[model samples]
Every structure is written in structure tokens, then in C-alpha cells.
Target: MSTTPSTTPEVRDDSRPARIGIQLQPQHAQYPAIRAAAARVEEMGADIAFNWDHFYPLYGEPEGLHFECWTMLAAWAEATSRIEIGALVSCNSYRNPELLADMARTVDHISAHDAGTGRLVLGIGSGWFEKDYDEYGYEFGTAGGRLDKLRDDLPRIESRLGALNPAPTRKIPVLIGGGGEKKTLRLVAKHADIWHTFGDVETFTRKSAVLDERCAEIGRDPGEIERSVGVETVQDAETMFAAGARLFTIGVGGPDYDTAVLADLLAWRDDKNA
Candidate 1:
């Protein structure tokens, strides 16, 4: 198998539009509600939609309604007509890197079928949900150690992608989430096409500086990595945009899967693009 560069691999700009995405948290909602939210977000002109990779809900209640990540992504692929879909950040610990690549490739094909527009952005991060590790029986180690594995495995994942029978119709964009200055941002500089983080404008500005330094240290251009931030409302949207964040993600929860907030986000997206 051909081993691709483990760090800072070249990415082709595929003419995908820049816009907003929402992480449809699987906690409180049922499948029907989640499907409706996906349809509504696409109709509102959001460019992408996402879900978290966790066995249980991250918030609300620990044992609340939840869905698996890759499986749910396959469903989203079939359910939506326009928006790009993937996990906001899939946990790397859950699956072997090669297997994850194959799964992503399969979903990429599923999304592209008949529609001709297939997009899957693999947003991955060092696994952090302790309950998931405990329930699934995977060892929860030091954060640094998990990030180390991520750094080592990224190239392997890319290498395996080339060997898959039907290569993904398009080059999959790798999105790394987290803002750990010592390792996470460094990994972002080295491996990610998109870097996502959660914070306010001040926090984001500070972390961006650290990420820039990491890029310089690694001999990579910081601008090559798309800066993404999670937004909760329109005010946060404007703040993040002003602070140099080009990609904004809002999160909506399940069961009720409301889109009232999404309407405002879409208006802001149009204003920025207009």
C-alpha cells in the first residue's frame, strides 16, 4: 500500500461552497425528528449537517435517546438531497483507522449515488467521552496519548483510502476538532483540512494564535486549514466571523430537533455570502 504523508498532505479545492452546518445531537430526538431536522436544515440553505460520535447522549440525560454515528450518517446520506453530511468529530479510538477510511468511503459512495453531488467530511478527534470508553470497554488513557495515536494513524487512514476498491468519488476533507494547545492544535496543523473548536470570540482568537504558531513550527501554512467554530446563536455567529472563523456550526438536539435558531443562522449565512 502507498503510504501518504502523515502530516500536511496536499488537498485539492473541489469547488464546494463555504457555509454553515449544524450538529444534530442525537440525545432527545427520535429517528423521525432527526430526519425532519436534516431536511429542514437543507431547505434553510445550510451547506452541511453533522452528528457526534458517541454511544450515549453528551448532554441532557446520560441514558437519553441516541443514535450511532456512522450508521446515522448513512441514514442522513439517504434522507437529505443537498447538504453535505458527516460527524462533527468522530472519535478515532472507536475504530481502526483503515476500517474508518473504508466506512467513510462507503458513505461517500452512498451520498453520491444518482444525485451526482457526493460530499463527506470526516471530522475526527481524539476520543474523549469517558462514558463511551467505559461502556464500550475501551481503555481511556491520557489525552496526550490519544492525540499521539491520532497523529500516528492519520497517514495510515489516508493510505488505506487509496487502496479501497471504489475510491471515494471525491477527496474526503479531514476535520480535526479540539483546541489543546500542546497536542490537539499541533495535530490540527499537521493533519486537518478543517480545524474545529468551541469557544467565544476571545477564546477563539487566543487559540487561533496558538494554532498559527503550531503551523509555523511544523512548516505548514496556517491558512491552509479552514478555521471552524461552533455557534449557538446569531450573535455568536457574527462574533466568530469577525474573529476570522470562516466555518460556523450550530448544534440542535433531538426528539424536539428545533430549527428556530437555524433560521437566524441561515439569514446570517446569506448575509455573509451575499
Candidate 2:
């Protein structure tokens, strides 16, 4: 891992083109609908297709239709040929670290098919959502304890990825989603290839500055990590882009799973990238 200090904006590759990711909320819908949305996002020119990791609906009828994350990702791996696929952020507590690594490797290979590289992004985070832990029979420990587990398991994941009989087709990109300045950002500095968060430009800037400080302490270039933000529409992405976000993710909930907002964002991405 190259950790040479990136002291200024020029040290980082600001010329990298902006990209769009569409997160199809896997709630209130059936698998067929979710699968179609995955294909639709790709046809609409989304750079990546994401589904969240959760056991239940995040809103609007907590007990409504829902699906597991990794299994659906496996389906997406075979369903779409061009789109990158993964959970927006997999909870580190849900599965054993090594087992998760094997699962990811399998999906990576599946997505690669005949292409030389895989499109799987291993977006992971320390567990939140107390209901998931309680319902799934895992301990809903303190936030700090969960962070400790994530810190401990990241290396284990990497080791397992290395030790697999046939290694992952590509070095699977690891996207760590959180903005916790103390522990989460520090872990992002040490382990993440992409960092996803939610906030206005000011909050994004402040937390990103903290991330830069974390990277500096570890002698890692901040540019090694891609800055990601979840936005509601194209208008919301402008400020974040100006604030130096390169990856913009739009989340659409299910039942209808409308892609209007995602289309608008993709138009903006095309212009920006051009």
C-alpha cells in the first residue's frame, strides 16, 4: 500500500471523471422488480448499481417486503453484464469475516465472466440498525464495540481474500461507508478504497478534512480514497461535486422503483465527465 503523503490538491488526481451510482432500495418490491431496476440502471448508463444491506424496510412499513443483500447481489452478478454490483454497505457484524470474503470473491468472479476485471465493490461498515442485530440473534453491542470488531475484521477479510484457493479476479475495491471522525474515518484511512457518506457540503467538507488528517497521520495520500455522497437529485450533487466528491449515488425506493432522478443525475455525470 502506497501511503505517500498527499499534501495538496495537486498531489491528488483531480482530473478523475465524475461517476454515478444508482442504489435500488430493495424494499417494498419483489425480486423481479429489483432485478429489472438493476438492468434498467445499467441501460441508463449508471456507472454502478447498488442495493443496501438490511433485513427490513428502512421506512414506510417496517415489515413490508424486503430481501437479503448478498444473495441479491449474487443474482445481480449474473443478471447484468455491464453494471458494477454490490451492497451499498454490508454490515460487518452480520457474517463471519472470512465467509464474507469468500462470498465476495464468488460474486466478483461471477461478474467478471469473460471480462478481465470484476465489478464488485465491497462496501462495508460497522453494524448499525439495532433491530437487525436483535432480530438476527447477534449482540447489539455498543457502537464503539462494533467499530472495534470492524477494525479487527478488515485485516482478516484481506487475509482470507489472499488465502482463497483461487483469489479474487481483481483486487476487489473496498468501500467503507461512514463519517465517524474518530474511528470510522480512521479505518477508512487505513483500509478503504472508497468512502461513502451523507451530508451537506459543509459537513462533507469537515468530515473529509478529518479524513485527510487521518490519512496524513498514516502517511497515506487522501486521493487513494474516492469521496462518495448519497444525493436525492442532480441539484443536490452539484454542491458535493464542488466540494470534491467524485462518486455521486442516488437512492430510489421500491414498489415503483422510479429512475427519473437517476436519469437526471446521469445526464449531469455525462456533461461533467465530458
Candidate 3:
């Protein structure tokens, strides 16, 4: 399989003010609420929608209501038309790199067939949730070890796509989430088309500078990698954007998935496009 960039058509608008993606957190929500929230986000003009691949909620209650990631994305792909869908960061430890590539490819096909848009931006990260590993019978190792595995596996994952019987109609964009400067950022500079970090404007600004330095060392242009950040409140949106965060993600938990807060974000996105 050739490692060169696939000839798939570029389907995203790179000029837009980054993009506003919502993480449909698998917690405190039910199926209907999650489904409705996806629809509302699409209606409100969100560019992308996402869910995390975890067995439990990351916040609120430890064992709160939750849903699985890939399964939910398959549903969201069918539920909405105009918004891209994916996991905020699928854990690299859960599945084999080849299998994961196939899964992502299948989802890409589903999104294209259902919505007429093959927009599956895969946001992947080194495994973190210890509870998930314990419950799933996987080993819980040091953070460095996990990241090493990810670095080793990413290229294989990319290569596997070419080996698949029917190639994905699009080359799914790979978004690597995490801000560890030494290891993670280097991996981002080398492999990621998008890099997602968590923090306020000041934090993102600092880390982004480090990322740029790493990019230089790797002979990669920092501008080539899209910078993304998670927004818990609307007020931080403009602040982060000004700090060089083009991709802003808002997380909405389940059960009562409300999109009221997303209205401001969508409006902001539209303003930029307009």
C-alpha cells in the first residue's frame, strides 16, 4: 500500500474559522436525547459532532449514564445530514490498528452513503481512562508506554486502509488529541492532520508555541496542522480563537442533551463563513 496521500477529494472547507464540533459525551444522557442533540446541532449549523470512546463518564458521577462511541457515531451518521461526525479521540489501546482502520473506513462509507457527505474526521489519542482498561481486561501501563504504542501503531493504521478490499471514498482526516509537548506534540507534528488540546486561551497559546517548535524540528509546517481546543463555555470560544485555536469543540453530556448553548457557537461559525 502506498503511503502517499490518497487521491480522495477534499471535502472540508479549510478557510472557515476552524470549525465548531460538539462532543456528545457518553454520560448523563439517553439514546433519544443524544439523537435529538445531534439533529439540533446540525440544525444550528455546527460543522462537526463527536462522542468519546469510553466505558464511563469522565465527569459528574463516576458511573453515570453513558453510551459507546463508535456505535453512537454510526447512528449519528444516519441521524443528521450536513454535519461531520466522529469520536473526539478514539483510544488507540482498545482495538488493533488494522481493525480500527477498517472500522473508521466503514464509518466513512456509512456517513457518505447516508448523508451524501464523507466527513469522518477521526480524533485519536493515546489511551488514558484507567477504568476502561481495567474493566475491559487490558493492561494499565505508564503514560509513556501508551504513547509509544500509539506512535508505533499510527502508521500501520494508515497503511492498513490501503490494504482494505474497498478503499474508503475519502482519506479520513486524522486528528490527534493531547498536549504533551515532548512525546505527544512530536507525534502530532509527524502524523496528525489535526491536533486537539484542552485548556483556556493562555494554556493553548503556550502549548501551541511548543507545537510550532516541534513542527520546525520535524520539517513540517505548523500551518499544515489544524489546531483544536475544547470549550466548556461560550465565553472562551472567542478567546481561544484569538489564541490561534481554529477548531473549537463544545461538549454536551447525555440524558438532557441541550443545544441551546450551541446556538452562539453556530452563529459565530456562520459569521465567519458569511
Candidate 4:
């Protein structure tokens, strides 16, 4: 799926202002508490809200008060009107591609309001987590195999979105998460509107250059995809932004869903944009 760089201009204008995102970790929090936190983050001026796709907690107790991803997203569609919502990266192996497309379309409609059309970024990636595979009876194939599946399914998901009776409210932006220099980055150059990955300034700079090379091969301007990264503090955000990350996300766990870290990052975003 190589797009000729000369033919495909940038999908997004990078000159746009930087934005902030919040990954309100679903583990260790009650449903009501999570709901409140989601709303509060939007009220606090977050540009987007993300939840992970996993059956169990990624940290702390293995078995904790974790909530399902898509279901919570559905509720968020109605619970909040201002903020966009989606999985940080929905595991491609967990659900059929067509079904996933339908689910996204439904949520897109649900989230659509007078303020705007439905906001759902179709963030997806190959599945990981052996526990999720074992307990759910999903195939925990080799990493390459999973990547192959993801490569095959993305086009199908797009096709399904086009074939739906009522299409998505807007062109759902595809956010592909991962930093695999080979297959993963290639897919991002071909399919993703936003690319999310993690690494320090040096690592990010190297991988980002690789991504641009991939885009050039396919004929798409590297700037077409927005660069996003997870940050633990304002300092990390500064480093990543200096390396070209435009979307900064902060993840917080639990019962309280602390927003202190988010406050600092948000302020940083304002300062940068200002």
C-alpha cells in the first residue's frame, strides 16, 4: 500500500496548534468514578480521551477493577459532548474487522451533537498480552503473525466503513500505535492519520525519521500523520515536542484518576501554542 509522495500531499497541516490528550486508565476505578473523570478531563480542556483495550489491568494487581474498552467508549459517547473518545489502540485480533467498523460507526453517531459530528479515532494495533488471549480463547500468535493480521484487516475495516448503511458521521481518523520500524511504520505511512508511539528524544527522532522515509517511499508527505507520544511530566513533553510530537498524552491510574500531572501538561500545551 505505497502511496507516491509526489501524489499525496500532507493529510494534516502540522502548523496547527499542539493539543493535549488524557488516557484515563480504566483499572482500579469504579464506573461512576471513571465517568466523572472523563467528563472532568473534557471540562479541563483536554483535546481527546483514550482508554486501553485490555481484559485485565496492565499494572498493579493483575486482577483489578478494569472496565471493557468499547463499552465504556459507548457510554462516553453519551456522557460527554465536547471531548473526542477512542481506544488508545484496539487490538486487531480481539474483534472481527467488520464488527469493529460497525461499532465505531455507532459510537460516532452517538457522540455526534450540535457541537459537531461524531468524534471517534479508530486507533488500532496488533494484539499483545498472553493473559487476554488465554482467558478469552483468542489466538496468541507470533508477533509477526499478529502484524500480518493487522496489515490485512485495516483495509477491510475501511471498506466496511464505506459500505455501512449510514456511514460514520465524519471521516474517522485512523490512529495506529506502535513503533515497529518495518511493518508497523509502513502501515502508519499507508493508513494512519495519527501515529502514537513511545520513546525518548533520541529514540523518537530516529523512529520519526524512519517514518518519514516510509512515507516518502509511499509518496505521502510525512507530515500527513500527526506524531503523538505519552508523557509522564512536562519535562518529558518538552523533550518529545522538540522531537516533533504534536499530541501529548498523560496516563493516570485508579480510584481517584489524578489530574495533577495533566494540569502541568495542559499548561505546557498552552505555553507552546501561545
Candidate 5:
């Protein structure tokens, strides 16, 4: 793999047009409703469609209707023709890394059949959410412990992907999500092709500087990892882009997944690209 020196922002193609993603929160909705929303987002020209991984609703009623992440992604692989589909961040603690790799590979083939490119971004993170552990019978380990596990498992996931009988259509892009200044940022420098985080201009700038330090220490280029942020409004997208974010995602929940918010963001994306 190629690495970029930290001294320059020119390591990767900064000229690539800004891309928009929509996180269709899979909570408090029926399967068909979620399916329709997924199709709608792709039709509206989203570059990526994301669903989060969690067993129950993260907001509103604790017992709200929700669907599993990877299963829905497999369905999305068939339902949408253009948009890239995957979890915003899959919890690495939920499944063995090898199994997760196989699952991603299968979805790659499914999505590749729809669009020639196998559009699976393996967005992963050290697991959080105590309820997911308590109810699911996973060990509720310390955050540091979980991060350690993630560090150990990533290589295994990659090896498994390479060893599969019919290999993944393409090398699945690894997207690491978190904002920890120490371990997380260092891991992002070493492993991730995309790094997703949440912050305003100053926070993003500070964390990005730290990321640059981490990348430089390892002889990798900071620009090689795409910077992504969650945006709530057009102004938010603009601010993040100015702070060096190129991939912007907005989250919408169901019951009624509104496209108006997405429309505004997409228009902003068009203006930026133009």
C-alpha cells in the first residue's frame, strides 16, 4: 500500500468532487418503509447510503422497531443501483472479524451485480453501547480493551478477505470511525482509507492536526484517508468542508425519513463541486 508524507495535502487527489451520504437510521420503522427510503435516497443522487449497527433504537422509545445492519445492507445491495451501502460504523465486537469479512464480501458481489463497482465501505469501530453487550451476551469490556481488540482483529479481517474462495470483487475500503486523540487517531493513520468523526471547525482542526502527527510518525500521508463528518445543515457542510472534510453525511430517522434535508445538502454538494 502507498503512504503519503504528512508535509503535504497534495498526497491524494483533492480535486475529487465532494460527495454526499445519507444515514437512513433504522429505527422505529417497518422493513418496507426502510426499503423505500433507501431507494429514494439513491434516486435523489446520494453517493452513499448508511445504516447504523445497533440492536435497539438509540433514541426515542428504547423498544422501537429496528432492523439489523448487515442484513438490511444485503437487501440494499439489491435494491439500490448506484449508491454505496454499508453501516456508518459496524461494531467490531459484535462478530468475529473473519465472519464480518465474509459478510462484506458477499454484499460486495451482490452490490457489484447492480453497479459494476462493488460498493462496500467496511466502516468499523471498537464497540460501545452497553446494552448491545448486556443483552446480546457479549462481554462488556472496558473501552480500552475493546479498542485493543479492534487493533488486533483488523489484520485478521484483511487476511480473511484475501483468503476467501471467491475473493472480494475489490479490496474493500476500510473506514474507521472515532475521534479519540490517542489510540483511535493513530489507528486511523495506520489502517483506515476513510475516517469518520463528529466535530465543529476547531475540534476538527485540532483532531486533524493530531491525525497528521500520527500519520507522519508512521510515514503515511494524512491525505490518503478521506475525512468525513456528519452534517445537520448546509452551513454545517460548508464549515466542515472548509475544515478539510470531503465526504459529508446527514442522518435522518424513520417513521418518516424526510428527503427535504437531504435535498438541501445535495444542492450544497452540487454548488461545492461546481
Candidate 6:
């Protein structure tokens, strides 16, 4: 993972316009509330709606109400019309990669009811969350090991997507989340159609440079992958946008998934794109 600068041309195009995403963290709230919030965000003009992949709550009461990611996404596929639906990053270890591919394809079809193209973004990453691993009986291996698994399984998932009986309605976009410069960025360079991570502008710029280096090493144009940042405010989004990020997302915890600010951000998105 040496950062020795490459002489390759800078083809990492970050010229894409900004789009807003909301992570309605499936925690603290009941199913009805989560469902309603998903529908509401679609109504509010979000470009993407994401939930997280975890067995338990990430914050607030650890045992508070929470829901699974994929099943909820299936419901979202039926519940919403326009906004794209997915986990922010599905844990690669939770389900078999082939099975996960099938699930994604099915959800893709479900979401493509109106238009013939699925709105499912297959956002995935190596598993984290010790509780999710322990409670679900998954082997919580070392971080490196889990990443290795993700790297290996991604191709299988892709192959399975190709082999599915009826075939996915469209080529489902693969969004990989994480910023591990050594391994994650390289995997992202190889497989991701969208790359997501959380950091300030400086961190994003630095890691994005490393991502550029990774893509150059493999002869892939980094611009092919969208840049997604998990942001909390307009200022954060603005700074990252200035630094070449196109997708900005906010996380809203449940009980009450307040998203009034999302309207403001959506306005910002429109302004940027305009």
C-alpha cells in the first residue's frame, strides 16, 4: 500500500452532480414508523434510501427495536416508487454471496415495477459489529480475514448475478463501503460502481488520492465509480462536494426519523446539479 505517486493520467472524474441519500437506521423505531419514514423520504425527493445491515441497534438502547436489512429492503422495493433502495453496506459475511446475489436480483425485479430497471444498489462491505457476528453465529474473524472474504466473494456474487434464471432487470449497481487503503480501496477499484465512506474533506481527499492510485495501478478509470460520503450537514456536504464527492448521505436514527434537514439538503442537491 505504498503511496508512491503513479505517472498515470488523472482520469478520476468526480464531475457527477450531487445526490442526497438518507440512512434510516433501523433502530429504536417500530416497523410501521420505519416503513412510513421510507415512504416519506421518497416523497421528499431523496435519490437513495438506505438501511444498515445489523442484527441489533447501533446506538441508543442496544436492545431497542431494530430490523434486518435485506427483508426490510424487499418491503421498501414494494413500498417506494422512485428512490433507490439498499443497505448502506450489506455485510458480506451475513449471507452466502450467491444467495445474496439472488436476493438482490429478486428485489431488483420488485422495484422495477413501473420502469423496467431496478433501483437496487448492492451496497456491501466486510462485516463489522461484534454483536451481529456473535448473535448470528457468524465467525467474527480478523478484519483482514473478513476483507479477504469480501474480495473473494464479490466475484461470485457477480457471477451469480449473471447466472440467475430470469436475469436481473438491469445490471445492479455495486456500491462498496469502507476506506481501508491497503485492501478496501483496491477491492473498490476492482469491483465497486460506487464507493462510500465517512470522513471530513481532508480525509476524503487523501483517501481518494489513494483510490486514484489504486485505479491507476489496475488501469481502471476511477471516475467509473461514484463517490459517496456519509455527511451530517450542508456544510459537510458542501466541503466534500468541493473535494469531488457526488453522493452525500445523512444518517437518521429511529424512534422518530427526523428528516426536515433532508429537504434543505435536497435543495442543495438541486442547486449543485442546476
- Among the numbered candidates, top lDDT falls to 6
Clashing pairs in 2: 3-219
- The TM-score leader among the candidates is 6
Clashes of each: 4, 1, 4, 6, 1, 0
Clashes of 1: 4
What ranges in model 5 sit over 4 Å off?
1-13
Candidate ranking (lDDT, best to worst): 6, 2, 4, 5, 1, 3
The Cα local distance difference test for each model comes to 0.84, 0.89, 0.83, 0.89, 0.88, 0.91
lDDT of 6: 0.91
By lDDT, the better pick of 1 and 3 is 1
Clashing pairs in 4: 3-218, 3-219, 4-218, 4-219, 5-219, 5-220
lDDT by residue for model 3 (1-274), tens:
2223232322232353658988888788778888888888888778889899999889999988888898888888777767898898999999999999998888888888753557788889998899999998988799999999999999999999888977887878999999997899999999898999997666677677777788888789788889888886666877776667778888878677777778887777667557
Q: Give the alpha carbon lDDT tens digit for every residue of 1-274 in model 4.
A: 4332232122333585788999988999899999999989999999999999999999999999999999999999999988889999899999999999999999999899664699888899998888999999999989999999999999999999999978888999999999998899999999999999997777777777778889989899997899999989998988777667899898888899999988888888899999
Residues 1-274, candidate 5: write the lDDT tens digits.
2233232222233565788999999999999999999999999999999999999999999998999999999999988878898898999999999999999999999999843779898999998989989999999889999999999999899899999978888888898999887799989999999999997777776777778789989999788889989999998988778768899999999889998989998998898898
The digit string of per-residue lDDT tens for model 1 on 1-274 reads 2122122222323233346888889778788888888888888888889999999998888898888999989988888777899898899999999999999999988888794757788999988889999999988998888989999999899999989987788888999999988889888888888999997676787787777788888799888888888988888877767667778888878677778888888888887777
In model 6, residue pairs whose N, Cα or C atoms come closer than 3 Å (at least 3 residues apart or on different chains), thus clashing, are none
For each candidate, what TM-score against the reference? 0.91, 0.95, 0.90, 0.94, 0.94, 0.95
- Local distance difference test, candidate 4: 0.89
List ranges where model 1 is wrong by over 4 Å.
1-18, 115-117
Residue 16 lDDT in model 5? 54
